[model samples]
Target chain A: MLKLQGIRAGYGRIEVLHGIECTVGDGEIVTVVGANGAGKSTLLKTVSGILGIWSGTIELGSTAIHKKSVERIASLGVVQIPEGRQLFGPLTVEENLELGGYAKRRSGRKAHAKLEEVYELFPRLRERRRQQAGTLSGGEQQMLAIGRALMAEPRVLLLDEPSMGLAPLIVKEIFTILGELNQRGLGMLLVEQDARLALSLAHRGLVLERGTVVLEDTGQALLNNPDVQAIYFGQHGGRRDSRTESA
Target chain B: MTFEQLLQYVASGLTNGSIYALTALGFTLIYNATDIINFAQGEFVMLGGLSAVSLHEAGAPLPVAFAGAVLTVTVVGILFELLAIRPLLRSGVLTQIIVTVGASLAFRTGALMIWGRDARPLPSFSGETPVRLLGATFNRQTIWVFGLTLVIVVALQLFYRRTLTGKAVRACSINPMAARLMGVSYSRVVLLSFAVSAAISAAGGVMITPASFMSYASGSLIGLKGFAAAILGGLGNPLGAVIGGLLLGIIEALSVGLLPGGSSGYKDGVAFLILVLVLFARPQGLMGGRIVDKA
Candidate 1:
């Protein structure tokens, strides 16, 4: 479980996250949907300790992590699959996955076990285990990014735009994987520009507008809300119109 | 020149090239980790040589002297990171690079104060008996240089490819932010890079001092050559650095042997010429595909 309270953070003097509060309960997938520059990535970066918060506290299961180093935060199991699928471009897919479990430095058997599990989840990765990450296609790269993060054996995964730049079919596959992982009880805080899919999969959803939470509701309720539909689902409830009507 | 004469030049070239390879390897480690061209890299080499000489003069056994010099210089590298690098980490890459230049000056002046201006010799690891190979004769130190450089390179390759820490370092070099998210400590990796880099350069310094007597000012030229070698091979690629070093050394030796009278005087200029040529023609070096991050 992860919690943030009145968190203020930014680049230099310009604040991006203005006293925002949020949480991801046990085995919960909390999706934050917002427009560009709405501080979604900043919130994740703050939680992962890549950026120091100006004020307020971030706690992972009651332990304060606001001032910890990025590595310390990660070792505490707050691993982030960064925006843009920032996999080690030159390293082999297996090497990238191996590095994911670096914090714990798992034993040979344990690491091998984790590797096997990840490969099972992404069989394409096993086939291309020796290939450099940069050479992978966009969908495969996204899979490798998720597979790499899972290698860390994280308790709470922070995903930033996992669907960005991914094709619709690939995004569907990714969301399916996320839903499957949540069913297995892996907590997640997902930031997405794909509001419909994120809400459909999320148990709870928050609409982030310019660094502030403008709305919070059950995913289905938010999906059916008039304002949410107007802004995110488009006036006529863009393609996949059937789902919007059903909601 | 006779074939034996050519063989002799290559043999000599290889001996010096081993030193350049070791020094360039140092540059690669630090450059890969921090993206800062540490000007003080040469200082570590000079420190290694001077410290070993002092220890030898003070009656420590040769092996003990060499090991002590490496340990001393490694500690200095760690201190430099903690005291100088850690403070300026947030100050941007250019500022940090400038600080290294300043550190080099400080190290040079300190060496001057401690050891003065005289060049000091480290007795060869083994007696200077000439070994013959195909009618070309070279000293035992040449064999030692080759053997040690080979050992260091093999050990380094194993480290990068086989060990978790080494992979973590490689990961850091590739993507520091991503590495951090994976729980790899960036600062610790940087520190390890500095320490290992200093130890390697120090070892090279200790080994080569017997052949080329070292003074307080010796680090500058050797460091420059090493940098040139790193650039020639591809700055981030370790194997490239070693090959570049050997090539540069051989070219310089060949130039001295074949060029007209007084050409030997320009032996040092050869590295710079190669350096400029590599930058203009193939900025990525021979092995690298593209410049990943620039300082």
Candidate 2:
């Protein structure tokens, strides 16, 4: 339940996302796929209030959240698992997760409510909970980033490249986990450079080109589209995962 | 000097080190939270010492005097944050730095006018008795100072480890943007850092007064030493500051023991020289992490 209309965002003197329009429907998994520097991550940053927008509106549910502080936005139940796994390096795995649910911990009892479920979801994290987050492997850290966001019990999870730098097997495992979470009704906006995996796990996919949404389609439809095939899937739609086609 | 002499030196060093460590710990805490080297920290300590001495003379009991000193300086720290630091919240670190440094000088000069240009001694709350260990003798005052500093550091460690607010502060230090996203008021956290930093510094001043001479102008050297200790320990690590402070004091003491002029005139130079070499050798300091220079 998030919407961005004609949103423009950028770093100083360099605009990245130019007038981009996108939406995440309630309980739907929406994926944004583009090359590096296509503003995929920038769009997520703008939505999560890490970067301010230059123009346009970003709405979480019906409320305009762009003007709110990052903490306020998070309290409003929009949590982001930023690119690079950026877990608090010196803190333990559990501490990182504890901080993820900081808004809830302060203002209410919501954090305690999710503690059991979070531990259940990432049992390995619970096992090595006391270990420094920096010491965790890339896959573990990615899982931690996701788990940390989940601890927030966010209304909308904005994942910026959860699959980045992971081994192929680990990437597959993580995507499988995301799809499972989506089935359990977690709304997500997954940003990725990998078209095949994102499209496979998502209900709908949008292609970003030069910071603009260039293509939007149902997952299966995009998987078979000729132009999408040419640019991302290969002319023969070769890289489309067999599991997604079967599903 | 005999083994007793060396023990006495170490005892004094430990007491002195505790003061430095406690002061540096505050600096490190604030730096970790806000990434701004608060030059005004020494004034908080100075303010504490001065307040205690002033109130004690005004017929206040020792505990009451100490409490007044702490409250007075805590208010000053909060005021400094609200009035001085609040405006520079969105400004560059350089602006914050210059603004704070200016505040420290203003504060020190203000104290000079208020207290006059004289070194003042605080009455020992505990009766001044020489406590003996082995063949060495040192004042119970030194022991109390070191004890209090140890208590503060341990309490701080517990705060960071066992408390939610402390964990939130640690999280903020690690990632402010992330902490903000988690609904921690960015401003509130920064101010909290300031309050805690100032409170710790004030406590240091309180404990230190019974052990050493204090004057308005002395703020600079104390602040510099505290800062050097923080840098030596790694800017954010409290444990680092303690170790760094002890290391610094021992080195300075040894310089007195070994150097040509030694304590005659070279003691200050010893601290400065160690500071320089530490900056050159391992600039990150002991408790420092993978932090880049904000400057």
Best by DockQ: 1
Error of 1 at B192 (Å): 0.7
lDDT of 2 at B33: 76
Q: Write down the worst ten-residue block by lDDT for model 1 chain B.
A: B286-295
List TM-scores of chain B, every candidate: 0.97, 0.96
Q: What's the TM-score of each model vs. the native?
A: 0.96, 0.91
Considering only N, C-alpha and C atoms within 3 Å, which residue pairs clash in candidate 1? Answer: none
Per-residue lDDT tens digits for candidate 2, residues A182-206, read 8888899998767877888888999
For model 1, state the Cα shift of residue B63 in Å. 1.7
lDDT of 2 at A10: 93
* Model 1 superposed RMSD (Cα): 3.1
- lDDT per residue (tens digit) for residues B100-162 in model 1: 999999999999999999999989999988999888898889889889999999999999998
Residue range A1-247, candidate 1, lDDT tens digits: 6999999999989989888889999999999988777899999999999899999999999899999999999999998999998999999999999999999898789989999999999999999999999999999999999998898888999999898787888988998999999999999999987788889999899988888899999899988898888777754323334345446
**Candidate 2 residue-wise lDDT at B15:** 72
* Pairs of colliding residues, candidate 2: A71-B180, B232-B285, B232-B286, B233-B286, B233-B287, B234-B288
As a TM-score, model 2 comes out at 0.91
Task: Locate the minimum summed-lDDT window of 10 residues in model 1 chain A.
Answer: A235-244
